[model samples]
Target: MMGKNRKQFYFGGSYVPLGLDKHVPMSEWEGGMCEMRRLGINAFRAFVSWNRIERIEGKCDFTELDYAMELAEKYVLHVVLNVGGMFNNIQGFRPPPWLSYACHCRHRIDDPLKAHIHEGADLMLCADDPVLQEKAYAFIEKAVLRYRGSPALEGWSIWNEPHGDPCYCECTLKAFRAWLQAKYGTLDALNERWGTVFPIDFPSWDDVCPSVDMSPYAHADPCMKLDFLNFLEDSFIEKFNRISALVRRFDPDHTTTFNLQGIHGHDMDRFQVTNPGISAYIEELAVNPRRVNLWLNMYLRSARTGRDGQDKIRILETDSGPRPTGKRPGCQKLASVRDWTFVAHGADMILSWIHRTRITGGHALQASMTRWDGSTPPRLETAGARGQTILRHQERLLGASPFSGRCGVLHDMKMYRYATVERWHGSFNFTTNSHDGAFMLMQDAGYAPEFMNDSMVLDGRFRRFPALILPFMPYMTRSLASALRDYVWNGGILIAEALFGVKDENMEQFWRKTPGCGLDEVFGFRCADMMYFDPVKDKILLGAGEIIPAEYFRECIEPSEGAAVLGRFPDGSPAVVSHCWGKGRTLFLAALATSRYDYENTALRTLIASFLENSGVLPLFKIRSEQNAGALGVYLATKDGKTADIAYLINYAEEPISFALFPDAGILPEKASFTDILTGKQYDDFAEITLEDRQCAVLFADRKDTAPV
Candidate 1:
């Protein structure tokens, strides 16, 4: 059973038992368990599909799951069972036929050219259907009660990527109406907020319906569409609450959490749990493995501020190797950095996709730790070596938490949804482009910033950061603007990029000035006009005589009193401006500079570096490395009441690089001694250390306290 002080870091891969779609025998299942023990894997995910467990309505089968739990107990391994209605669509085992076509109720939204039904396949049940919810809850209750006391059961994954975006059937329409009623309170209020008129006005609540057309030119009103999207997400959260409450009624001693697909579709503040899980596949979250740190820190910050205020997270699914027929090589190299990245960020558990490859069908030649015949490959060997290394120092490592920066980057969910509604480069591309670029730029300068989401802003968490960056944020809530003003008034540095606060909380353009909600006075600027241009032809000139290429979006600005112009466009328009407001300072870039700071952009990096230094927010200790030493990562941690602080270094470069650390006085004791945790090498003073490609190093240094000297 897990308690408040429980601190066991789990690491393992998933496995499919016998009699599933893959048709593995019981012998192979037992062998897989043995392999887990040999590889130092202490926990795994056990899948319980609704279709498989309940072949006939009102009758359930627990034979296979029972044996799997017994095997886990015998092997001294922990199990995180995957049950309930909301599981992965592909491996979640499609719903049973009785729950599928018998009720004639499933997602009816589909392409005009394609059929909705397939042979031997079933769609997910409509979540708004009362009958469906009753049966799903019944199944969940029985499953939790059966294994609540099992020695090996650790937790439950109640929802897998809970996104109901595709369901637009009659049942969903009914739910959407009810949601609107609760929000607007009356049809007249709804009509006023939605701005509905004669031909399109919602005369009655019954006339309101969500749009099924998702094309670029769909005629759905942005206001109505936004509410529909909110309703979908809220419906999922409601289902999660009901199911979680039911589970807790029977099993209150173990952890309960749900998995989300990356960080796009849901609100971070809505759901709070001790352990929050995410599906962190590189293909889904990052363009390449080297950029995975951006998502890692974003989710880690969310988990750190969870219900129990613990810094524990679960990577419910990550890539173990490359896909079949893919051109990417060095699977072992990528896998090592991926798993270690989780550890560097203070993650509690790491669970990859699968343990062994399948022998047949479309999933043939899929990536797995072991071959179909149960032989360990080079990748598996690398995993085993890393596992042994982590197990050796679990006590000290688990006791420490990753250090967070005094800086913050804003991630506004309202702006993210507005982008989707406006059809401006889509949601993920628009938000992550700016958020990831700002995050990477900070890390490149050896300052890793935490992410402050919309929830954080509303809850007064934004005031904790000494410096904050708003990257390409265009939408603003009145509450958020008020918080930013208060934060700046109390002496916090604020930096915002292009299109900051052009739209209100409801995606309405501001009538007075661009930075709405009194932010014009706070930032000392008003956007007169804006333009989009071809970045290849335009350029920006900094006050220091540095030439930087322009990006796609730029804003024309008029500076207010006490504001100074720092940069100019080709036409001599104000490109960047700075102001003194209250006791703090504010900087505004007329262009999206942060979105364009790639690995090769030196000019932008220099400009951003100057901004940090001028604001007195740069890291005290600088990590210097040779050129082409691709994206080195540095993370620090300290045990409670201990004099030794730990630092973790990760090198993503292809060639060997020499690293040196220089400390600023009063921040790090100049006479402190260094000890390598992995190698046990002691250095009398800070010295140069060599790290090969994709290497991770842990160093311990004695300190007077966890504060500046």
Candidate 2:
């Protein structure tokens, strides 16, 4: 129901009424609910850990949950009930002591009580265990049947930050074998693909044991490692789907969602790949504003879609206040910036980690909406103010959507899998850094492009974009290669960096020409040889004898007769080439130029601007500022009919600065006026707007022919 129109916004905090015995206390629930209502907060995410309600098997005392639902109904607040196997409380994944003991025994491990749970906090019951999963299902069914009719119950959150780490239990091993058998059909096929030999040979399906050794020196078979990761991901997806289907079976009217951890160990293309509702936490996970922007962009792309369809995107748990661990403390200004950033990025909902202070847990001293005595803090006030502003502008906000032009950056999980196996430590950043860099480069050039995954491409979503960029993608599949070739031939501009498809999807080197999989002809070049380059020392020779810095890796490219050399290495070997393929064009960089950009470098941004210009991809608008242009982030949300748009200009710098928004040639040609949403003041011209340090301004722009303000 929430995704029906994709226009609603929900804002609140996470409230944990952990039974009647713990957290915020039974006495403070009514006050907390009253405060939430008074602040104009519409919804909150409440949790019910398995350990808290049913410590003893078959006996669930739902008094705390029932009271929470009643209070929510009384306060006229909606609730997104988080019911799952793992509870991310201070105790951390405490799955009923009895269940933990039983699972340890079944898995032939030492007693869970004797184990140091903190060191291995993720070690819990094998999710593949049938009996254990049945118990979980029964518990969920009971909860759903009790609250499905309640008005306060808006939906259900089934999984919280799902992980794909293998349990290595007997049940999990059996499930893994089944998964492999279904994939390969025979041990010979599996062994051949994985190159299994004397030491780690899988004579039988049962002989396969997933190796979780990610140490720096561990020499695990790359193919086996990739498959193991895939198997675990598949298993996680299966469990989540089963639970989601179970919830819908009983409560068909309500929606089901999951909170995604950042895209480090997990892959968004695998989980909630194309789902309509997606939630994620970003408080402690993202270190800086730039990374926060990156995380939001990635999640927004994964959650929401292009013009064809849309999804409900929620920042489920952002920081509410300062943490006891002073490393990443939260303040009123920081909280405000983060909340507005989410709103600007098109988040449908924004919830803090908590509403009230905890009585016990590792985060006992962490910041909350209310203090121990149910008093509001500065951050709470900030939330209330932001909520009020959002409520006031709900109509315009709902009618508008972020405008991302026809350009997409590819986010392939196979490349992630390959990097994880080959370069374990910083492998996760290998693909992501380039992605973030490319995204920022586009942003700096006044272009808003969405991120597309392999599944989206295979399903024909890639055809929606006029240009596609592949940043450090090395793994290639036959089908994907074919699709990409067709895309380029049909007039799609493709920009790629070094090591493009040098390896197959299985992480094996390609036998054909260097670009591999018929791509050498598509790009009119092949990688002759490659070597590591120094970021500070190596230089690439550009047009008119201009030189720019190169980094990390370099490829000596051999170009076809029809290809034009764009740049050359120090020794005059072609480093960047541009070629015409069919009706489209392909630009290939034989170096890691995209990944080498930082705040100090203008090379990547300049290169991106040139490519976009040459390919005729016009940016939405241009920013004119005397200050640091990178410090100001510009976002535009266009009304459905394209008669008006809303712009959010955020100044991430410390000092005040003035800037102007000049619409691109054909975009917003006859715009009439700009009105600040917060101040309710209208300006007829878009010449100047000055913002203080870390401040943001929201302006509504109406065209000349639209309704008058």
Q: What lDDT would candidate 1 get against the real structure?
A: 0.70
What C-alpha RMSD separates each model from the true structure?
A: 3.6, 3.5
> lDDT of all the models against the reference?
0.70, 0.71
| TM-score to true structure, per model | 0.91, 0.91
Q: Which candidate is the best by lDDT?
A: 2
Q: Could you tally the backbone clashes for each prediction?
A: 0, 1
lDDT of 2: 0.71
- Model 1 segments beyond 4 Å from truth? 2-5, 18-20, 85-92, 101-120, 196-199, 212-218, 283-309, 326-330, 359-361, 640-644, 663-671, 683-687, 702-709
Candidate 1 lDDT over residue span 259-359, tens digit each: 67766556655664557787776534333435555566555554444233235677777776556554434256556666777776677778877667666
Model 2: ten consecutive residues of lowest lDDT: 105-114
Error of 2 at 536 (Å): 1.8
1-709 in candidate 2: lDDT tens per residue?
4323345577898785642225876777888889889888888888766677787887888888889889998998888877653432211255566655654433322232333343243335556767767777788788888888888887777776666555666787788889989998988888777764235557777788776564665666687888877887777777777777777888888766766765544545454322333454445543455555556566666555432323445677667766767455675655665667677766667878777767776566676777767788776877888898887787777667677555787866666667877773384365767877766667677777777778878889778778888988777889999999999998889999886888887777875678889999999898857898777778887876666555677987889989999888888888889999998999888887767665446665666678777887777777777766666677777766343377787765556769888766455637567778766777786687888876777878866678744
At residue 481, give the lDDT of candidate 1: 90
